[model samples]
Target chain A: MSNTSAPNKDLPGTILAFIFIGVGCLAWWDTFDMGDSDSYVFPRAVIVTLIVCCLLLIGRNIIWGGGKNHKPLDGSAWRRIGLVLAMLGTALLMPVFGFIIVGMVLFGVLIIIAMFEPWTRKLAIAYPLIGATIVISFYLLFAVLLNVTLPTGSLFD
Target chain B: MENPISYFFMSWSDPYLLLMTAAGTFAGVYVGAIPGLSVTMAVSILISFTFSWDTNEALALMVGVYMGGVYGGSRTAILLNIPCAPSAIATAIDGYPLAKRGEAGTAIGVATVMSFIGGLVGILVLAVAAPLVSEFALMFAPRDYLLLAVIGILLVGSLSGESLAKGVFAGALGVIIGMVGLDPLTAEGRFTFDSITMMGGIHYVTAMIGFFGVAEALAQLHHLETPAIKQKLERITPKWSVVKRYIPLSIRTSFIGVFIGALPGTGGDIAALMAYDHAKRSVKDPSRKFGEGAMEGLVAPESANNAAVGGAYIPMLTLGIPGDAVTAVFIGALYIHGLNPGPMLMIETPHLFWFTVGALMLANVFMLIFGLTGVRLFIKLVECPRAILVPLILILSVVGTYAIQNNVVDVYWMLGFGIFGYFLKIYGYQVGPVILGVILGPLMDVSYRRAIISTRESFGDFMLEMVTNPISALLSAALVFLVVSQTPMYKRWTNKRRSV
Candidate 1:
C-alpha cells in the first residue's frame, strides 16, 4: 500500500489512465456537438462512466502504487514494436504489391527480427519455401476455394 | 413435414454434409490452435461463401467449426500458456503447468474427452430443453436483458488478474469502442468525429482477434528464446478409471456452461470461468493445486466451455436471440439464408432445429476422435521454434482481419488495438474485459434505450417498472447481489464473520 518505490513500474498505468481520460473527454466533446440528444444519450452516459473509471485508475496508482513492479516496459519490447510495424507496412503495401509478395517479404523480415538469429543455410532454403507455401495457401483458401476477391496488387496487374 | 428422425440423421445420410463437417472440425483445430485466427473469424468468412449453399450444409459445417474451435483453444493454452480464445483462459492455469511437467499429452487428452462429454451434455440439454427454455426466454423484457448484460460485465472480476480498477477501465474502454459509429436506433454518429470509417464502428470480433491473437503473439516475444516444454507422448488418452473419476465433475460444470451459454450476452467464456472458480472451491483436494496443474482444474473448464456451445445454440435456435458472439453470427447466417430464427423458427422449420442438434452430436464425436489422435503432432507444433511461429501468427492475424470485410481500415484497427492490447497486458491490465465490453456494449445500450423508450423516456417510470415487473425485479435483484458480493466491504464483513 506504500508508494515509496520508484514510479517506473506504474508508468504504463499512468499513461493508460491519461489516454483513457483524453479519449473520454474527446468523445464527450463530440457527443455535445451531435445535435440530437437521442443519438448522444448512450454515449454521454458511457463516457461519463469511462471518465470516472479512468480517474479511479489514476487515483489507485498514485495513492497505493497499484500495478507497480509489474512487467515494466523494457528495450526488448521494441522487438514486438518492430513486428507490429512490419505487419502495418504489409497492410499498406499489399494493395500495391499484392498480398502474396508483400506477405512473403514481411514474413521473412519479421522472422529475422523475432528469432534474433542471422540467416543460416537451412533457414535460407526453408524460409522461402515455407513463406511461399503459406502465402499461396492463404490465397487459394480465400481467393479460390471461398471465392473471395483478394487484392491482386496494382503492380502485378 | 418430414419425420424428425430423418431430419436428425440428415448429415449422416448426406455425404457432402458429412464431409464438410469433418473438414470443418479439422480446420477448426488448427485455426483454434493459431493465436490470431478465431472461430468467429472463420465462420464470418464462411458466411460469405456459404450464402449460396444449402442452409443445411452451411449449418453443418459451422456447427462442426464451432464445436471444434471451442475445444481447440485449450491446445495452445496447455502447451504455451497462451490461450487462443478468451474461454480457454482458466485452462492455462493448470494446463501450462501440466505441460511443464511433461504431461501436455495427458492434459490435452483429458481436456478433449471432457470437452466431448461437455458437448454431449450441452446438446442433450438443447434438444430436450430448447422449447422449455425458449418459453422461459420469452418472458424476459428489455430491462431484463440489460440486467443480464450488467451481470455479464461484472464477471470481469474473474478475468482481472489483480486489479478491479484496471479491469473496470479496460472494460469501460471496450464499451467506448463499442459505442463508436452511428447510434443503432437514431442512425446518428456518436463518436465518429466526421470520418467515414469511424461511422462504421469497431467490430468486437476485430477487437477480440487483436486482444487474444495479436496481443498474445507480442507477449510471446518476451519469452521468444524460452525453450519449448517437451511433452510426454505416452498414455495420451486417460484410462477409463480417470474418465470415470471426472464424470460427476464434468456433469456439474457442463450444467453451469449450459445455463450461462443459454443466457443472452453471455457465452462459453463466462461459463468456463465460473466453472473453474467452482472447481477450485468444490474439489476437496485436486490432483495438484488449482493453479498448479490440477486435473479437476482442467476438466471443469474444458467441459463447461464445450457444454456452453450447446447452450449458445439454444437461444439462437429456439428463441430469436443469439446466446453469444458466434451465435450472433449464426443468426446473421440464418437471415442471409432467408430463414428467421426465433420462437416461430421451431414451429416452422423444426427440421433445421433437429439438423443442428444432429450435427453437434456428430461434431462432438469428430472432436473426440481428432482430439485424441493428434497429440504427438500438435506437441511438435507447440514445440515449433518461436522464431517461425510468431511471424506466421502475425500474418494470420492480418489475413483474418482483412478477410472480415475486405477492408484495409479494419486491418489498421486490428494492429492499433493489438499494440494497445499488448501494453495493457504487460501492465497487468486484462484485455479480456475490454473485448467483453465491446461485445456486450451494444446489447446493453440498445436494451437500456428500448426499455426506457417504452416507458416514455421517464427515468422514474423505468425504475418503477423494473420493480413492478416480476422478471425485471428478479434480474435487478440478482444484479444488485452480484455487485454487492464483489465489493471489498462485503468481503471484509464476510471474512470478519467467518473468523468468529
Candidate 2:
C-alpha cells in the first residue's frame, strides 16, 4: 500500500532473500550445538554461504531499483489467469468426471475462450469429441495396456 | 565383450526393435514440435510405459525418443520464436529469423543435416570413449560432483537474459523449491512443513510442465492476435554446396556440443548456447549477420544441441551421472531394463553399450528421413488456428503431467506453478535458471554436505581441500572469472577503458 514504487520493485527479491537468510540462520542455529566433528558441519557451511549470497543479491537489487522500469499490467492478464483457473478446475474434475468427460468439456471451453473464434457446428462437435477420444485412449494405454492405475470416476462405476 | 558386429546385426535384424525405433522417433518429433512439450517428458513417459517391457526393447524405445526429441525441437524453433525445449532456444535465435525471411525450408534442411552429423559424431564418441571415460570417471568424488554442480549453476548467468542478479535470484529460488522435498543427506524434511504429500517434494517433471508448458501457454494468450505464420514452402532439401560450406562449422560446433554434453550435469541447451556464443565470437566476417538469420547461427546451435544428445550419454554410461534431466530419466529406464550404469557397466555389460551406439546411429538415420519429410507437416502445424492448437497443447500438458505419476495432485501443482511461472515470466524473470537450480540443487546440497563431513570439523579445511583439489580448483577459478566478467562493475570498467 505504500506509494513508494522505488521500494516495491526491490521488495519481492528482498523478501525472498530474507526468507532464505531466515531459513539458513535457523539451519545454522539448529546445528550450532553440535561439536566440530559432527556431520552437521558442512550443512551449516552451505546454509551460511546461501545466506551470504542471498543478502548480497538483495543488497544489489535495492541499490539498482531492481533494474529497468516495471511495465504496467497488460489487459489480457485477467483472462490468462481465468484460463489457468479453468484448466486447474478441469484437471481437478478429471478423476471425478472421468478424464474423457472432463477433457472434452474443458477442451471445448478452452478452445472457445482462448481462440475466441465463433464456433462452427463442425468444430463444436469435432473438437470435444476428438479431445475426449485422445484422453480415453491415453487412459486405456496407461491403465489397461501399460497396467498402470488411472483414476476411474465413480460415474463409470 | 560381445562382438560389436553381432550386437549391431541383432539390433538391426529385430523387427519389433525397428518398429519401436520408428514409432519412438515419430512420437518424439510430434511431442517436441509442440510448444511446451519436451523430449525429456516424452522419454520419461516412455520409461513408465516401457517399464514392464524387456531391457533391449525399453532401451530401443528410449533411445529413439531421445534422438527424435532433440531434433524435433528445431521444428518449433524455426517456425516460432518459442523454443520447444530449452536446447532449442539458441536454435530459435537464428531459426525464427530464417523463417521470417521465407527460408524455413532451407533452415530445416540445414538443421536436419547438421543434426544427423551431430548425432553420428556423438554415437562415434559414445562407442569409442565409453570404456576410457568410464575408467576416468570412477575417480570422481562427492567433492568433484559438488564443483560440477556449481559450474552448472554458473551457466545460469550465461543463459539468463541481461540481468545477472535476476537470473541468480531465479536460480536460487529454483534451488530452494528443489529443496522443498526431503533432504537427501539428513533424511529430514527441510521445507515440507509436515504435510504428507509435501514429504515427497515436487517432481522435476511437474515443475518442467509448469515452467515450460503451462507458463508458455499463458504467455501465448497475450500474443494470441498476432498474425498466423505464413511460410513460403520451398524445396525442403539442403543443397550439397550449402552443406559443404557449413561442414567445417558444423563439425566444430558438434565437437563443442559433444564435449559440453559429456560433462556431468550439462546438456544440449548449454552446448547450443555456448556453440552459438562461440560462433558469434569467432566468425569475424559474418558476425554482423549472426542474429539476422545467419546460416552460421542456425548451423552452430542446431548441430551443437543434437551433438549434445550424444554427449549426454557419455556421463550416463560412464559415471552414472546424467548429463541432463532427460538422460537422468533415461538412467532410470536403464535400471528398469536391468542395466545398472556406472564404472563397472562397461565391463559387465559391454554388449549393451554397443547396442546403444548402434541404436543411436540408426535413430539418427531415421531422423534424417523423418526430418526431411516431416518439415512440411511441421510447418503446417504452425499454421493451425490458435483456437484448436492452444487447447490441444493444454490437454497434452495435463495428460503428460498426469501420466508421470498418475496423480491429480501433480496436475494441481502444475497449474499452481503455471500461474506462478506466468507472473515470473511477465516480470522479465528467466525460467531457465530456475530449472537449472532445480536440477542441480540436490547435487549441490549432497556434495557440499559430504565435502564438509569428509573434511572433519574444520570449515577452513573443507574450503582448503576444494581449493587444493586440482579439478575443483580449476572449476572454482573459471566460475570466479565468469562471475566477475558478468558483473556490472566489470562492464563499467570495460566501457571506461574503451572510451579512454
Candidate 3:
C-alpha cells in the first residue's frame, strides 16, 4: 500500500458540492416561471440555504478532511450490482411479468448471487421451499387480507 | 371528565384489541431482532394493512409494535454482534462479549427486565407531561410554530450525520421534494413541472418506505454472506440480586432516555448511546470490564431505549412533532386514520388520550411476556440467511408503497428514492434528517406563510416578531445555539476550556 494516511476524498466531495450547486442554480431559475411570490418564497429560501450548505461542505472537506469515514462496503462487488439489478429489474418487469413472476425471478437471481455456501443437495431442496413460502405468505397478506391488487402483467391482459 | 378510568382499561377489556396487541408485540419481537428490519419500516407497512381497522385497533397494534420493537433489538445485539437497529448499537458492545463468555442468556434476561422497567418510566412521564405540554402548546403562534419546525429539522440534522452541513443538505433536499405539487395557499403549482401527475405531490409514506425499507435492504446486500454466530444458553432468568443491583442505574438512565426522547427529532438510539456513555463514566467497577461483557452495559442501554419509546410519544401527542422516526411514522398512521395529532388532540379526543396510555401499558406488559420466553424459536428465526431476508424486504416495500394510493407511479417514485438514498448512505449522509424534513416541511411552509401574512409580508416585521415574542425568541436562540455549536470557533473554544 502506498500510504493509508491520504485518500482522495476531495474529488468525490467537490463533485457532490458542484452537483448541489447545479441543483440550486436550476431551482433558482425555475422560480422565475412561478406566477405568484408566495409559491416560490419557501422553495427559494430553501434553495439558497442548500447552496450555502454545499459551499460549507466544500470548505469543511478542505480544512477538516472527509466527514464520516465509511468504506464503500466490503464483500463481493458483483453481489451489490446483482442486488441492485435484481430490485430494479423487478420493478421494470413487474408490469410485464406480473408481480409474482417478477418477484420469484428476483428471488432466484438474488439467491444465486447472495449465496456464499457450497451448493449442496440439501440447500437445493431447502432454498427453493423457503423462498416460495416467504413469497406466498406475503402475497396472501397483501392481496387477500389487505386487498391490494397485485399486477397480473400486461401480457395476461 | 367523563371518568377516564373506563378508557384506561380499553385494550385490556376488549378481546379483539387484546389479541391485536399481543400479536403485534409478538411480531414486533421478530421484526426488531431481525437485522435490516426496523420498527419504522414495520409500522409504515402495517399502516397499509391496518387502514380499514377501527381507530382503536390500529392504535393498539402500532403501540404494541413500537414498545416490543424497541426491546427486541437487544436480542441480536447480544447474540450475533449485529445490532438490528440503531438503538441497540450500544447493547452489542457489552452484549456480544458476554455471549462469548457463555453468559448470553443472562445478558438477554437483564436487558428484558431493565427494558420493562424503563418502558414503565417512559409511560409515566408521558401520562403526566403530555397533558401539561398540550396545554402550554395552545399558546403557540404561527411564528412560534415556524421557528419550532426549523429547530426540529435542525436538531435532527445536527445530531444524525457526521457533519452538520451534510445533514442540513439532506433535510433541505427533503423539504424541496415536499414542496412539490399544489401550493395550498395560492392553489397554484409549486414544483409541478407542468406534469398533471405532480399535482398531488409525493406522499411522505412513499418517502418513508423508499428511504427506510428498500434502501436498508440494498445496503444489507453488501453483508449478505456474513455468517451467523451461535449463542450459548443457560439460566434464562437473572437472579433477584442482579436485578436489584441495577435498579438505581436503570432508573437513572431511564430518566435520561425520557428527557432525550421527548426532544423533538431525537429518539431511543441517541438515548441508549448517552446512557451507555454515562454508565462507562459513572460505574467504577463492573461484573467485567466495560465492552468485555459488563452487566452494566446491557442494563443501561436496554433500560434507556425502552424508556425512550414513552419519551418519544410526548412531542408527537402534545405538539404534533415527532421525537424520532418511529413516532414520525406513527403520526402518518394517525393522519391516515382521520385523526389530527396536535395540541388539540388531547382536548378534542380525551378518550383517545386515555386509550393510548392504556394500549401502551398493555404493549409494555406484552413485551415482557414475549421478551422472556421463546428463546429457541427466536434464535432459529434469527439464523435465517440474509439472502432471503433482503429480497422479502424489497417485495414488502413494493407492496406497501403501491397499497398507499393504489398508484404505480408511487412505486416508481419509491424505487427512484431507494436508489438515490443508497448512494446518499454510502457517502455518509444520514437519511433520518431527510425524512424529518419531509415530515416537517409542509408544516414549516404553512407556518412561515401564515406568520408572513400576519406581518403583511414585511420581512423586517417578521424578523422583529421572532425576537419580540417570548416563545419565538427562546426557540430562535436555541436554533442559533445549535448552529453556533457546530462552528469551528465554538469547537476550538470548547477544546480550550477543557484543556484548562
Candidate 4:
C-alpha cells in the first residue's frame, strides 16, 4: 500500500469553501436590491462572516494536511439513494392514494429494498400485516383521536 | 397572594387531575421516544384536543407532557443514535456509544435519575426565583439578544467533528437558508428568487426532522448487514455510589439548563448542547472519554434538557414571553384558554402558577418511574434488525413530517434535507450546528436589525452602544472570550502555562 492517504479531503474541502463563497456572494448581492437598510444589514453581516469562514476553511486545508479519506459511496450509497427515491415516491403518491395506502406501499417497497433476506413466504405474509397495523393505528390516532385531518386522496374523496 | 402550599398540593387532592397528568406523561414518553415526534409537536397537538377541557385539567396534562417529552428524547438517542428532538442531540453523542458497548441500560438509568434531579431543580427555581428572573429577562435589549444569539452560534465549536471551519460553514449555510423568507422589518422578499415556497422560508423543525431523523435512517442503510449489539440486561439501575458521584455534576449542569432555558429565544436544545460543552471542559476525570460513552456526557445533557422545562416556564407564567418553542406553544394554549400570560398573570392567577409547579413535580416523579421501567423493552428495540429498523424510521419520519401542517411540501423538504445532510455527515461535517443556525438565524436577523435601528443605523454608534451598556459590554466580552478560548494559539498558550 502507498504511504499516502487513500483519498485527499483537501480537494473536497476547498471545493466546499468555493461553494460557500459563491453562496455568500449571492446573499450579499441580494441585500443591495432591498428597499431599506433594516432588510439588508443582517444578511450582509452574516454574508461577510460566512465568506470569512469559507476563506478560513481554504486556508486551513492549505496549512494543515487533509489528505485523509473522504467517505466512499459504495453499494451502501446506492442503497441510501434508493431509500431517498422511495421516500420521494411515497411523498408524490401519498396525496393520490391516501397516507395509509401509500404508507403500506412504502413499507412493502422499503422492506424489499432494505432487507437482503430472501423473500420468504413468512415475511411476505407478515410484512404487509404489520405494515397495515402501524399505518392504520397511526391514522386512527391522528384522524380519530386527535382530529388531525389526514390527506384524503382526491380519488378517495 | 394565595398560599403557595395550598396551590402546590392542588393536584394531589384531585384523582382525576392526577390521572390526567399520568396519562399525559405516559403518552409523552412514547411520543418523545419515537424519532421525529417532538415534544413541541405533541404539546401543540394537545392544545387542539384539550380546547374543550377545564383549564386546570388542560394545564396538568400539558405540563406532564412537556416534562416527560424532554426526558423521553434521550431514549432513542441511546438506543438508536437517532434523537427524537433537537434537545437530545447531545445525548446521542455519548448515549449511542454507550449502547454499542452493551451498556444501554446503565446509560438510561443514569439519564432517568439525573433528569428527575434536573427537573426538580428547575421547578424549585421556578417556584422561588421566577419573579426575579422575569425582571432580569425584561432588562435585555435587542443588542443583548444579538449577543445571546452569537453565543449560541459559537457553540457550534462543540459540534465540529473534525474541523471547526466546516461547522461554521454549515451553520452559515443554515443562516442563509433561514433568510430565504420575507425580511421581518422591511417586508421584502429575501433569497426567495420569485419562488412562492421560498417566500415562506424553511421551518427549522422540518429541517431538524430531516437532518436528524431521515438523514440518520439513510446513513443506517449503509450498515444494513451489521448485526445488532446485544444489550446487557442486568444491573440496569445505577448504584447509590454511582448516582451520588454524578449528583454534583448533574446539579451544576441543571443550573446551566435552567438559566439557558429561561432565555426567551433559546430552549432545551441549546441548553443540552451547552451543558455538554461545559461537561467536556469541567469533568477532568470522566468515567470514559467524552462522546464515547462517558457517564458524565450522558448525565450532563439529560439533566440539562429536562431542567430547561422549568426554566422555559419562568418567562411564560410571569412575562408572557416564551422561554422556548414548547413554551411558545404553551403561550398559545394559555391564550386559547382566555388567559394572558403577562406581568399580572401570577398576581391574578396565583393558583395557576402554584398548580403548574406542583404538576411539573408530579410529572418528573412519573418520568422517573416510567423511564427506569422501559430498559428491557428499549433494549429489544436496540437489538432489532437494522434492515427492519431503517425502513420503520423512514416511515415514521414521513408520518411526523406529514403531521406538521399536513403538507406534502414539508415532507419533500424533509427528504431533501435528509439526503443533503447525509452527504454532509459523510463529508465529516456535523448537522447539529446547521439546525441550531436555522433556529437562531431569524432571531439573529431580527435582533441585529433592531439593534442597528435603535442606534439610528450609525455603525460607529452601534459599536459604542455595545461597549457603553454594561450588559452589552459583558455579553460582548463573553463572545470575544469564547472565540479566544477556541483558538490554537490560546490552546498552546494555556498548555504551556499549565506545564510551567
Candidate 5:
C-alpha cells in the first residue's frame, strides 16, 4: 500500500486469484463426489491446474521482484479505481434497487465524473432525470413489452 | 463448378428467398454501421430471433447479417475514427484519412464496390476450393492444431504495442485466464477453485466485450473533449477511372483475404492488416499519400477483409470448424437446423452448400444498396455527443452480454473484466493478443492434450511429430523466422550493413 515502494500491480490480481483458487480447491475437496465418472473430476483437475498456475505466478513475481519499473499510482489512477468500485457497487445493489434506479443513478454519476461536464442549471438536474426516464422505457420494452423478465427490486413487490 | 447457370436459375426462381436476402442485407448494413454494435453481435442476436424459423430463412438472415456486418464496420472506420469491429481497425487507418480529406462519399462508394467484389470472390472460393481445402484440413492431426495455436500466440508478440516482452507477458496472462473454468481433455477445473459459477469458465464473448468494447469506451472517456467529427458529403461518388485503377490491387488483396480467411482461426482483421503490410512493402510508388489518404490503402484492407469473410466460411461449411467467432456462432445455427458441417455435409446436403453460395452473392448486391444510402445517416451518428452515446453503448454491451444466456452473472463478469481491461490499456498492453489468446486458448489446450494422449503420454514423440510433419515444420520455421527478424540484434546488424 506504500506509494513510495511502487506497488507490484500484479500482486493484487495474483492475490485475488489465489483466494479464488484456494476456495475452489476446498470446495472440490469437500463436496466433489468422485464416484467413477462424477462431474467433479473435471472441476478438480481445473482447480489443480489453477493452483499450480497461481503458485507459479506468485513465484515468478517474487523472483522478478519488481524488476520492471512502473509509474507510481497517481491521483488519476485512484480516481479510475474509484470509478470501478462505484460501478461494482451499483451492480451489487442492482437487484435491491431495481434495474431502472441503479442504472440511471450509475449512468448519471459516471457521466458527471468521467465526462467532467459542468453542472449548470439545465444539465445536472435534467440529465439524471432524463437518464432515469430512458432506462425505464428500456425496461418496459424488454421486460413488459418483449416478455423478458428484468430484475425488479424487492421494493417493487 | 456445378452448372453455374442452373444454380443461378434455381436461386432466381425462389422469390421469397430473394426477398429474405434483401432484408438481411439491409439489416446487416444498418446494424454493422452503428458504432459499438458489431456484425457478430448483430448475427448472434438475430440467431435468437430466428430460432423458430426454418433453416433456410435463418441462414438467409444470418448470412445477410454476416456480410453486412463485415462491410458495415468500414463505414465507422471512415466517418468516425472508431472501428465498428476489430476487422475495421485496418480499414480506419486509410479510410478515416480519406474521410478527413472531405471525400467521405467517394471513400464509401469505393468501399461498397470493393466489398461487393470481395464477397463475390470469397463465395467463388467457398464454392470451388472448400471441398479440396477441407480434405487437407482433416489430415491435420491434433499436433498440427497445437502448433497452429502456438503460431496464433506468436501473433500476440507481433501485435503487442511497443514491448515484445510486455506483449508476451500479456499473452501468457491471457492464456492463464483462459485456463480458468473446465479443462477440455481431463474435464478438470484448472483454475476454478470451488465456486460453481467459476466452474463454468469465463465465456469468450463476455471477455471480448469487456476487453474491447468496455475498454474502448473507458479509453475514449479520457479524451472526451476532442473535436467532434465534421463529415462532408460533397463529391462522394468514385470516378469510374479511379475505380479501374485499383481493380488489380483489390483483386489481389481479395485473394489474400480469402486464403487467410479460409485458414481456420484467422479472420478478416488479421487478413486486412497482412494485406495492408504486404501492399505497403510491395508497392514501389504507392502514391505519396498512402497512409495519409491513399485510395489503394482503402481498397486493399476493404477488399481483403470482406473476402476473408468468404474465406472463413470455407472451413465452417466443409469441416464444421469455424474460421472466426461469427462463423463459430454460425456453426451453432447449422447444428440447430439439423445440419452438421463436415465432409459428410458435402455428400448429404449439396443443396445447403448451393443455397449458402447463392445467399453470399445476394448479400453482396444488398451491401452495395445499403452501403450507399446508409453512409449519410452513419456520418450523422458521429456528430452525436459522446456523453449520450457512451452510456447507450454501455447499456448495449450489458444487454448483449446478458442476452447470450439471459444470465445476469455474465453481465457482472463483463463489468469486472471491463474494469480490469481499462487498467491493462493504461499500462500500454495491447488488447488484441489477449483476445487472440482467449479465442485460441481452448484449441491449444484441447489439441495439446489430445496430441499427448494420442502419442501415449510420450512427450518426446509429440515433440518429434511437431518437428517431423511437413506442414507443422514449415509453420514452426515461419514462426522462428518472424521472431528472429524482429529481434534487436537483427535490426542492429541490418543497420550496420546498410551503413557499409
Candidate 6:
C-alpha cells in the first residue's frame, strides 16, 4: 500500500546513495588546497563526520542484511533510467530549443515512458492536447503573471 | 497598547486593503499548493510589481499570502508526500500515510483547523508580547543558535534510526551541498571547483523540488498501474472532540513556532521540525505511530509553522532585523513604504505596528476559510492516475526550477539531485533531515565560528563559556538530555518504568 516504496524490497538502495557520497567525497578532498584556513574549517569538519557516518552505514548493511524480502533492481529499473534520461535530455536542450518547445516535448516523452496501458485512438489524441494546454498555461502563469522571464532559445531568436 | 484601537482594525475597516488581503490569501493557496512554487519566491515577485502601489496596501496583501502560504504547503504534503516548502516537511511524514489510507480529506481538515488555531495564537502573541519576545530572541548567544541547529539535525538521528549512520550521513551530505558557494565569512570558495556557475551557489528551493518533487515521481514509476485511493470527503471540518484533544498540543507548538520564528535567522521550517520532535516525545498515546498516519503528527507542525508567521514579524517591527528571507523582503517593503523599522518604529508610528497586528489577524481568518474550502478540489489531485500525474509533476518540477532564476544550470542541478534523492528514498531513508541540514548548515557554520571567536579561539575557553553562561548552559543541558534519551539504554529504562 506504500506508494513510491517498492513495497517488497529490503535492500535499501545503499549502493546508489553511497555512490553519490563517493562523488561528494572526491570534491571534498580539494578543500585541503584552499588558501584560507577560515574557509575550509567547517567543511573539513563536516567531511570527517560524513566519512565516519558512511563507514558506519556500510558496516551496518554488511552485518545485518536488510528486509528478508530483499531483491535486486528489476525490470522497472529501465523505466526509472528512461525517466532520468528524458528529463536530462530536456534540461540540456531547453536553452537551445527554449522552455515552450522543450516543455511540450518533455511531457510527451514522460507520458510514453510512464504509460502501461495500450494506446487507444482517443488516448493518442487527448494526451498531446492536454499536455500542450498544461504547458502553455504554466508558461503564461510564470512569464506573464509572476514576471519570471522564461528561457527563449537561440532557435526561437 | 498606546496605539488607537482603530489602527488594529485598519485592514478590516478599509475596503481596498480588505480586498487585497482576500485576493492575496486566495492566490497564496494555489501558489503554495503547486509543487515547486515557494512563498519566498511569491513575496519577492510581488515586491517588483508593488513598487508603485501604496505600501500599506502591499503589506496587507503580503501578510495574507505569508499566513496563507505557510498553511497551504500542507496541502501537497498531505495529498502527496512532496512538501512545497520546508515548513511542511514534517506534515508529509504522517500526512502522506493518511492519504494512502484514503483519509486525505480528514488529514487536510485537521491541518487547516490546527493551522488556524496556530495562526491566531501567533498573531495574539505578536500583539501581546512583541517586545518581550524580541528581547528574548536577542538574548540568544551565537553558540545557542549553533546548539539549536545541532539539535535540529539530531532529531533526524532519532527517526527510524534502525541504523543511525544513514540518517547522519544524508544530513551531513546536505551540509556539504549547502557549502558549495563562496564562504560567507571568508569569501573563499568551499567546493566550487573553480567554476563560475558553481560560485552563485545552489538554491535550496531547487534542492527541495529535486528531493521532494522529481524524486517522488521516479518512485511512482513502480506503481503506475496501482489504482488511486478514493478519499472520503464527508467530514471536512474536524469534530469537536478531535479539536478538544489537540488544543493543548496546538498551543504548545504555536509557542514553539513563535519562539523559533522570533529568532533572526530561523523561521517556520525549523519551528515545525522542532515541534514535530516535541510531538514525538510528548504524546504517549498517539492514535497511530508518529510517521504512520497519526493525526498528532499532522497537527503539531501545521500549528507551529503557521504560528511562525506572527513570530517572524516580531524582530522586524521591534529591532529592524528581518527574521528570515520573506521577512527580509518585508524589511525592503517597509523601506519602500517610507517607514523605518527599528526601536523608534513603535514610539514614532505605533499605528503601523497596530495596523500589521490587525491585518495579520484578518489573514488568519481568511486562511481558515480558504484552507478548509480548498480541500474538496485539492483531494482530486491526489486521485489523478499515476501515469498522468507522474509526467505532470516531472514537467512542473523542471519548469518551476527554471522559473527560479531563468538558468539552465539550476535546472541541471535539480535533475541531478532528483536522481540522487530517488535512490535515497527507495533505500528507505527520509530526505527531510537533508533539507533541514541544507537550510540550517550555513547558519550553524556562521554561528559556530562567531561563538568560537567570541571565546578568543581557545577550544578550552569555548567549552568553558558554554557552561559559564546561563543560556549556553541550559542549551548544553538540553542537547545532552536529547542524546541521552536516544540511547537504547534510555528506551529500555523508560519501557521498564512504564511496565512497572
What are the runs in model 6 whose C-alpha is more than 4 Å off?
A: A1-27, A63-75, B1-3
Per-candidate TM-score against the hidden true structure: 0.87, 0.80, 0.74, 0.93, 0.77, 0.95
lDDT of 4 at A135: 78
* Per-residue alpha-carbon lDDT of candidate 1 for residues B109-212, written as tens digits (9 for 90 to 100): 99999999999999999999887765675677788877776665655644334566666667778888988898888898878888999989997767877776
Give the candidate order by descending TM-score: 6, 4, 1, 2, 5, 3
Top candidate, metric lDDT: 6
Chain B of candidate 2 achieves a TM-score of: 0.82
Better of 1 and 2 by lDDT: 1
lDDT of 2 by residue, A10-74 (tens): 56656766776887776666554434423354455556556766777677777755644455644
Off by over 4 Å in 5: A1-82, A115-157, B1-4, B30-55, B72-114, B232-250, B263-305, B315-349, B495-500
Best by TM-score: 6
Tens-place lDDT per residue, model 1, A1-157, is: 4444444337677887898889888988898767876677777887877788778877867886665576344448578768888978988998899888888888788777777566699988997678778878887877786665667899878
Chain B alone vs. reference chain B, TM-score for every model: 0.84, 0.82, 0.66, 0.94, 0.82, 0.97
The order of the candidates by lDDT, greatest first, is: 6, 4, 1, 3, 2, 5
Error of 1 at B355 (Å): 4.5
Question: In order, what DockQ does each candidate have?
Answer: 0.58, 0.32, 0.59, 0.59, 0.15, 0.60
DockQ versus reference, model 3: 0.59
Model 2, residue pairs in steric clash: none
- The i-RMS of every model, in angstroms, reads 1.8, 3.7, 1.8, 2.0, 5.6, 2.0
**By the TM-score metric, which is better: model 3 or model 4?**
4
For candidate 1, list the clashing residue pairs, or say none.
none
Candidate 2 matches the true fold with a TM-score of 0.80
Residue B228's lDDT within candidate 3 is 43
Task: Give per-residue lDDT, candidate 3, residue B314.
Answer: 86
Candidate with maximal DockQ: 6
Q: How do the residues B208-300 of candidate 2 rate in per-residue lDDT, one tens digit apiece?
A: 677766776787687677755677776787889988988888889998888877767667876887778677657767633766888888888
In model 3, how large is the Cα lDDT of residue B76? 70
